[model samples]
Target: MRPVSVRRTVTALVSALALASTAASPAAGAPRTIELVNLGDSFSAAFGTGGLQQVEGVDSCDQGTGRDHVDELGSHPRVEVTLDAACAGYTAQEVEDLVSTKPVREALATADVVTLTMGGNDIGWAEFIGTCSAAAEAESGPAPCDALLAQAPARIAAASSSAAETADAIGTESDARIVVLGYPNLFDDRQDSPLISAGRAAQLNDWTDELNAALAAAVAEEGAVFVDVTDRFRGHGVGSADPWILFAPEAGAHNLHPTERGYLCGYFPGLLSQVARTR
Candidate 1:
């Protein structure tokens, strides 16, 4: 879970902020604070990162008051937050739960921004991981990995489309900058590549690509922001670029999940910047 940084594609923040110019801002007397509502699965939830502190059954990440985005983005802001409601292995349906169960007034009543990363679990990412791994191991066959990946394009489209609808609905009601984050490399490509093939890496990455792309497209169509972190996570595994995740079989590994280091290195940077953008 310790990483400096991976080979990032570096989509600059200036360009990302320019995309959000139509949202509402806080009232003049209200503190110029960025109230972030992270409604997603584990990644944005700050799970395993020990960054969240729950109060009265309500979860909130450290926003550093006027520096919530600054603490995360390493800069200053009027106010920032690290709201967390991300559950492990969340799906499209679970998103409704995230919003419905929360104290809406506390979390979304004055929400300036919202970030989500869903639909992978909806498409059965865990199943895809196991299946794709097995298929990659059985490389002697007619490329079962290819067949499994074939389903990704359609599944991602359906799941993302549904997710986009939900985001739009919430955004309209709360006037928040709804940002969607894409998944990273969970599978090791070496498994089928004869180099390392740790489990079902290649096929899984390919499928991940499909899901990520679909998510980006959906966010765009929904008029929400898209925060892609796919390429940055490639070297998270053992002997990886930055080793953000512990190769499995180890105890309590955040495998298939973003490591704390990954969070500091890439996730938080890309995310906080988008959340702090002015409308």
Candidate 2:
């Protein structure tokens, strides 16, 4: 029989060898996964594309219809979406507020990557679209659109500042790689809308460009990557032969939002391209 001291020494050696082996090779079937967190407003929430469901247990947030870009990204083999904090109607300031909330704060603590889409609401984009649509329906000239355009520069500046602040706050709370997405043009300038003229559509598209530029600058200010989907979405706006954005005659929340195809094809590819380049 082995002596007790000899048995003890043998057991320690075996345990050390096992531990070293375990450390050298990960458990079978366990692949490295990236923890992704989604944060922002309607664009990030994928408001119009899918069936409404609660997000992070918040009924009002409507996050889990599975058609959002985050969901598309989560479908990636290497990614696991740990949190979806995006909510419709949320502004940049509101997203900043989320950083202080327990759920978002905890999620950020372990996030490997964070994606944000905001600032459109802060600049009254929805209202601008509605107002422009109404004027077009009334056969009114571009005066109303012009007035809104005149006010847009200041609003864009404010929204850009707010976005920068929000990005900074998110960076402060997490070491995650931040990717911000810019809004796409809802109208194809090449075609005339039944309600709005081609020139007006061009104007709206131009405004979208301005908004994207401002957002890009703001994201850069906070060291976040800004992924622009405009190129991907070109010729796919409301007036295009094949529109990716939802268009409804009556005003509602989902109008102007991307469809599932839009998320899957346009936004997701744009995001992937940027992430790949950065990585």
lDDT of each: 0.59, 0.77
- On the 0 to 100 scale, the lDDT of residue 98 in model 2 is 83
Tens digit of per-residue lDDT, candidate 2, span 76-165 = 555678988898888899899888888888999998789989999899987777667745547766677788878988998999999999
TM-score of each: 0.71, 0.84
Q: How much is 30 displaced in model 1, in angstroms?
A: 11
Please report the candidate that would top TM-score against the real structure. Answer: 2
Model 1: lDDT equals 0.59
C-alpha positional error of residue 75 in candidate 1 after TM-score superposition, expressed in Å? 10
Superposed Cα RMSD, model 1: 6.3
Give the C-alpha miss distance for residue 76 in model 2, angstroms: 2.5
